[model samples]
Target: MLAAMPPSPSKPRNGGESHIRDRVRDRADACPGALRLHRADDGGLARLRLPTGVLTAHQVAVLAGAAERLGDGRLGVTSRGNLDLRGLPDDCGLALAELLGEAGLLPSAAHERVRNMVVSPLCGLDGRSHGDAQAWARELDALLCARTWTTALSGRFLFAVDDGRGDVAGLGGDVTLLAEPGGCALVRIGGLSWRVAAGDAPSAALAAAEAFLAVAREAGTGAWRVAELPDDRPLEAAVTECLAGAGVATSAASPGAVPVAAPPEPGVVGDRAVSVVAPLGRITAEQFRALAPGPGGEVRVTPWRGFVVAGLPGRAAAKERLAALDRAGFLTRPGSPWLTVSACTGRPGCGKALADVRADARPLDDAAVRGLPVHWSGCDRRCGHPQGDWVDVLATGDGTYGITVRTARRDNDDAQAQR
Candidate 1:
């Protein structure tokens, strides 16, 4: 008999009650951008959107300096391959925007937040994958920025340019372009695919996004995402027609490719590359400063809440740094508890929150909790929940928590008794 897999932990239960009205139900809330910060209960939160997860050494230094000077000396890596700085002082938004713009980080003022794009971190690093997606990312970004109509697109809209490995496409992006042999590619929007040549990938993606926006506007139901549009809209066909109009030959593909599983692992690859994972997607300002390699070395913030430091000094030096980071609990090791846990700010940070979920979660030994990933939420909105299957631990107004497991559909209660 084969060895049995580990038994998954019991799913957390939810109180099944919520007091805050759903802002995203009718339309997506304006997610914070570097230009526009969101005032959280704790402080101002600024999200720096990275379209292709690419960043230069100098850019990384700028971010580190900004975090130290303008906000709390900490950086939060978002699930969308973006960077976030919390606890920013009032009136710092404009300065942050100007600094980012000067560094070529802010390409467009109107389309900043709407530039929701994610790419595989190992795209160019791994030889087995297709050619670098960086050039294509730039092309698509230019198309998005130049198009005035794209300003109307919601911040929730997502675009993924994958290099045939299906890494980012699996994130359920609104638009995905998957590479194939013979210079052909597959473009997918809302789970629908269209076959197109490699050269047309950028235009095809832009057209698909435009099609989604048009459908959403026509629906007039305040739908923010393509999936929210009624089924009758037929978004896929509309996108295909739009691509054709753009002089892009297209056809449908059967049963699109599946997403791949490659967690961000920190180590020295070859003589220069080093991958580092930010624990629970958060890193201190001091940590970032230490890792900011100057010139020749670049940082690629990944959608997986980690960053790859490339072009290091030497293999031995890179390995030593990686080992140090590992010891400091920055690397995503096999049994690291941080990998299985995520939490949203609660308590003083948000007036809508019922409890200090992060504070409560800080004491839990996640190593003791196995199986499904666990996300702690102060309210039912479950903001920042992992895209994949996870166990939900929701706080109730009565100072207790309800847990809901996605796989088992089981519920349980844990009282927050005093120690």
Candidate 2:
């Protein structure tokens, strides 16, 4: 069983790695964890990582209770399957931590920030996936919390576990595990991949991270991601060496691109799952409770700022649950104008915002956007925007806004309208 551990003292860096530490460029990653509250314009913000986005109904109620009593009476979902509780008092850190620890949310204080993992939301429920990514996530998360050296990893580091559906592999994780057919898995770092037995996937993935840390320490560039590492280092070779040292057997495989797959549409998924999205990725405490699964069921928070309630008895139960969620003001079906629309925390909540983007977005309709996955930003920072080609609605000044279509090759201004 996972339990909370006290903070451990920082270990000393070796002479060779310490010498190059001064040359590191990227500043320390200060991403907030459950214990570390980030002070925002609205109030203190606490981000809790949910490995594989698994949360019991009781856990959901606990979080909702915490949000109502400690911070703002709402919850925000991140693209990485994490929850953000905002508008908290400055001194609410201990209270928040206590609430989370009691609910089994904070497994380890030292490893809280580094426990970032996102698995396919509809993995086993949809019956489209080959293996259980959630199981791998559980194993990997426990392994991460047990190891002390993993605390050195930045909070931004991510692990994407795909059940061969390709849904999360393209989401960009520092280390990725893609479940393949015939009881095997592919462990990928950047362009390189090593095929290993399904049972060894988690260990291989951990070894990959260990290798990256070694390479990063050698380069001493404070690189938080594999893409940021120096070009000269052969990361694939390092990972292979680590895997061998860890006694994980691997087979040769060519470097291949990660598979790309979009998230499931918002509605009933298959026979036992229901997918729903909060309008603009924000929901009130009552609305959050409405998403709770039945006893023994689990809710999987999607990377697309949505929720997937799984483990239903059958199709009828899923439809009934979906109807209840739809009645609760969640976007449960398709054709909802807010389906692809999103906005940042603008106005009073965000000091840098030029306008209340959410308020401004509340009035728009299908005609307002010509494409899907449109995002409204308070400014150029464009926080919480969706990936891939989409419309960018940027707040300019006064009541005016700028609209542009962004693609891989070009940015074309489509219109300028008033909010």
Candidate 3:
């Protein structure tokens, strides 16, 4: 749904614009969606944004089939609880879109890419939840897809509906609704939260999106994301004003506890579900197809770059699959080496990369990385760092790397240690 704005001539030649232009020029580095495919160095990359991380079994199978037939057969579960199919052939964009649309995966062609929504993976399954956020997520998604103006929103505009545990809200969403008791919810936009009646969640969220777009347009900043907007256009105040205009009551609530639970470290959550981690968020085509559960069973892809097969037949079978995955070098055990480290594709896939950061980083055992979560990058664009806090290892064009640890260190320690 996201459209690229023409570059502004009056804008200064900042490095940010240059980088974006370079990406756009090379392979049309647009964010991949079901309809608009991104041509990576490897091939075409298609990202299927799964709003609410909920998919029917049939939909999943269709995705698997598309990946096998049109793509390279490997599927990537992204940190946004979305799926990516790489190595796609040319001219497959329309066909793939049609296939996904037939499966109800592409509800709206214009809104397909902008429908970035995430909810608690355990919203309904977890007993401690305030209430099911799934319904609200669906309602909001429907509203988003139906809006023609929403096509102007950037592909990165995120909406998260958390079921009161503060899970999805912690990831810093453009618009977030945290479920509360007494049939009410807390709505937040750009770090500010407001309590609203539960019945107003969807409308309030839509209002927030509209307010954001208004601010972006007024700012004339050519900013595509909420975070990039100038300081004068405070998103919170705009959202509040928009909601009031819609006759929705609101009250401020400070951002609450967002748990730092790492992806379920390769264990049994309960008698029914088994968690599996795809190392570096990559899974082969055969692995994806083989992992699809039977009828009445489902897979829940977590925002932490992992997935769970819920309602398994037995613990033994699940354990066997987990062990097999582990043997294939996937992380399925608590404290596994792959759990602590994450890296973006470097030399081969990205032209901006200075080195093969992923390959160079593969040898560093996670057990040796102490203190904080560590993310390796090929360039300054640290695509995905731990949402809360983490150590950053940035690569220089000269093949050296700089490390920035978020934790306090001893007197002799250096924050920007070079390696």
Candidate 4:
């Protein structure tokens, strides 16, 4: 029988609680990037940001090539639409930077880590969006790089640009720009929002970052994200003041519920596009190349660990591509078992991991296996679990497991012992 619950060390996160910080960290953020490779149990790991997850076919090929030559033969997709390369040698940093820079992936080395931004993947292509958030996302990325102070923003600080659909509005961004009617947008800083011209969204987002920096300086707590600030600090007032000082005009957003559509599933979007979900958030070099068939072709990597391939000749052609991808192991059909499972780089890749979570995930015969989104974590970090309600299958180091599920109807953690 399976059970749910782990010891405190491998506990699933209580959404109501903070990320284990009772006080400010009092140190620099150590989020790893292409330039700053993180030392993992499995060698140097690099996370390259794809702002809005847009990568040309050539860019994808370059990354896949790098994965085979410089490090592991696989590419890991992130919930935030970025890519990770693990198992690199210690001296591969310089070489990796050169390859990435040549591919136009690293625009500003100084601001690389702070470029954690995600845009509504379907914004420009679906035509249902109120604005071109894809364009806005790129513009914002450029603006963030042009400013030197933006580099001070924490690597964990996230900025989201949603095209009035609310798809990514609730992803816990430090700063969010939501599309509004009449070609305007709402800039949300903390709980408050200021109205800005659609064109001014980029600068306003930067202003929001500056505002966070200002408050962080005063708090002196080294708060990495807006939500992590001391409970006593007032976030709204400070961000408003920063915007005013930056000469960006503002108005409070109306207090009400924002309607967010469910994230796009695998299917033809509109008439000319289809989304392909990567199984278990892992896609290989060949798969990456397939997504970007020819040079100059573009693919939008989504926060949901999928790719939106647009600009097809027709619905038939899009469905044909989806079928081809499905044959090649990419999940192009809804309700695939792979959609509900995610695992971090466990075992040989992550020293902190207690077990090979991915290997363990394959053979679970329980009914709950496909009932809810389940993340198999080697340790407590649960690095890339789904955001909303789901089940967590955590491996306890001492030859057992813990299963925890948190949903609107129930929340419980139970311990499991091996037979």
Candidate 5:
């Protein structure tokens, strides 16, 4: 799939109805994909998109070997449930691509980057969901790759298939499908939503995206996300027409708040699923080896910094497996310090960074941060910050740091403190 992308110009974009600083991206994003590596200060950076975040033990081994042989022997996890391999030698891109293709990780060259989908990772196994979101996710991924128009979607465009769980729906997907009771789903585009048959969720989601493209084209802006549309654009009307053109029926969603579920803690769920938290959202080859199940077992990585291994023999067995993972340095219990802290690739990895934030960051005890995340950044870009509430620890010149605490505050206020 990586090899399929033609060497296109990193073209700059122009013309738009209106633009906001955040939504106004004047250039196409050069976000690295598994095949499209980015030249970072830490050498080549390759991001592998894992739809549904499912990977087998064999795949894990392949990645581990690649990390050891090509990268810096560490696997970084993205908030979107994707995997990243950094510090790769420039000449090893072809080798990495070959390995990924052979492992079936690169299914469609054209659709690899657009496969930015996050679903309810613990769905089917937990029995806490209204429907099987994992099934929907797979079906949706297949549907996405089958259509050629989906290739036009920006790499940042994301899809969320939530099993009536609010956890991932709030993760900011351009097109979101929240499963509802009675075999129905709420398809949301921007703020507008429509209720449709669960079976048609994939088509509805695509239709909504098609509508976004139409509105964006009319706006004449190189807008990448639905939230970037001009103020004059009517999302609801456009989406409705697009769905109608697709021969899909829809009904206005009921007026209410979307339900949400907090992330699952590292433990056994019911009698089948077991979760192990990856400390600092980073894991090593040996750590991954310790977490892999025997042949035929499955692992589903979650949006949060860990993955859930379902298909356990029983609840008792899951406890044992989770305990083993804990021993291997995974955060297996709640209230662990690793749960409330994260940092970006500091100093040696990012050329723009002034400090090695990862090295300087420490796990924050719960009471210290009071359950709010504390992200350490090497510079003001504050890359890889968490989606929700958090404290920003940004490095300023001359060994000083700037701190900004943001949480539901659209307008931010900043404070400065010295190291």
Candidate 6:
């Protein structure tokens, strides 16, 4: 099963007592970007946002080379379709930026961090999707880069473009565009949704984000996302007004109209692509090279911390590529324990971590870790833990870890808590 990203809405902790904190923000988000590197225990960390997670083989080779020369040789796959380069020297920001710019990965430095978008990896490759969500994401990315005001959006803010297949619609995007069967798309923000023409979907999403900025300014709450807005300040009406003013006709969509589907499993997707994941979302330099496609081959990064290599010649060719990746230490097929296991950078990399969670988790391949998802975290933040019911293995300062089961549904808490 594909591990879920942390849910957008907070789940109650310590027996459903409501662990929700103040939604108002007090400071600017220090989220790292290609231009601004985050200082980590290891070194400076740079994140390159791949809008729609589309990367060329040449781009992949460039990133791998940069990781080897400037940072750690391993590339980190984040929950969003972004890449993280850790263990970099303090002065390598300029060098790294230069390399990414040469590779065409840095399109606009001003909007580098705000281009946080996730698109269904198998959108057009497989005939399952109703429309090409990746195309829409490209249009939206251009729009975001052109608008200076979008720079104010928090790096944590996300946008998802899902083909009618529903793979990415449930990814907890601040703004989501779900393609429908009738040449229209469902634009959603928080709990509200509106239907718009497929051709106008990208603009509608941009308009929705613009409306949120205005509402957030009016509330004076320093809210970074729609979910963080105060109860009294809803974004529904403002988004509606923005859509109407932009000349985009929208009709109210039923909650049932929302598409719900699981993420693409690791294997041959349809007949033209293959999906795979590295154990614990860590891709070594050699493995990264193995994932590089030919001149114009597309590699899509999935939100589940996986890679979807699409546009293969055929299923046999896809399987051959999968075999090559499997030989390079990637989990090319499902059923491996690593498929359901994930851990954060602990000990040496994260100053707050109590232990080396990745080291602790790497040995579990031989262990019978089955059933629900398992996430090993270094601290309470549970940084990249999966959503819904999960086995929480938290480091406890000592060599041991505190184990617990977290369930999203209140009614299933007792029944689902295995440990």
Query: Model 6, 144-169: lDDT tens per residue?
Result: 99989999999989898999888778
- lDDT score, candidate 3: 0.71
Error of 3 at 359 (Å): 2.5
Residue-by-residue lDDT tens digits, candidate 1, 1-419? 11211112212111322221222245466788888889887789999889878888778788889999998888999878899999998889788988899999998998898888887777766564664566778899989999899888788888888888777877758788888777877777764677777888899889988888776666565656755554422575577567767888765476434566655555666677778777667788777766676567777888878888777788887787788777666863555566667777777777789998877774244544465678888998877776655678899999999886653212211211100
TM-score of 6: 0.89
For candidate 4, list the clashing residue pairs, or say none.
4-403, 4-413, 4-414, 5-403, 5-414
Q: Which sections of candidate 4 miss by over 4 Å?
A: 1-22, 231-233, 362-371, 407-419
lDDT of 1: 0.73
Please identify model 1 stretches exceeding 4 Å from their true place: 1-28, 327-329, 362-369, 407-419
Candidate 3, residues 1-419, lDDT tens digits: the string is 11211111222123233222211111212677877887778788888988877666777788888988998887887779899888888889888988998998888888889999887777665475775687888899898888898888888888888888777777768788888887888776654567778888888888988988897766565556655554422565577677878777776465554443334557665656667777877777667665576567777787878777776677776777677666765677787666767777677777778888878774254444563667788987676656655677889877788876653332112311210
Clashes of each: 8, 0, 1, 5, 2, 0
Clashing pairs in 6: none
List residue ranges in candidate 3 displaced over 4 A. 1-29, 232-237, 245-247, 255-262, 313-329, 363-371, 397-400, 406-419
lDDT per residue, candidate 4, 239-326, as tens digits? 5666666666665456454455667888788877788888778877788777874333468898888898877778788888888888
What is the lDDT ranking, best to worst? 2, 6, 5, 4, 1, 3
Each model's TM-score?
0.85, 0.88, 0.82, 0.87, 0.89, 0.89
lDDT of 4 at 341: 76
Which of the two candidates, 4 or 6, achieves a greater lDDT against the reference?
6
lDDT of 2 at 358: 89
Taking the tens digit of each residue's C-alpha lDDT, what string does model 2 give over 1-419? 11111112222233223333344345879898888888889999899999879899989999999999998999999878799999999999888888899899999999999999989998887778978898999999999999998998889889999999999987778899999988888888766678888899899899999989888877777877765564423575678788888788887665666788878788899898899998888899999998888877889998888999988888999999999999998888877767778888888788999999988885355574554678888998888776567788899967888887676334212110100
Q: Model 3 Cα displacement at 43 (Å)? A: 1.5
**Each prediction's RMSD to truth:** 9.0, 7.9, 7.8, 8.5, 7.5, 6.4
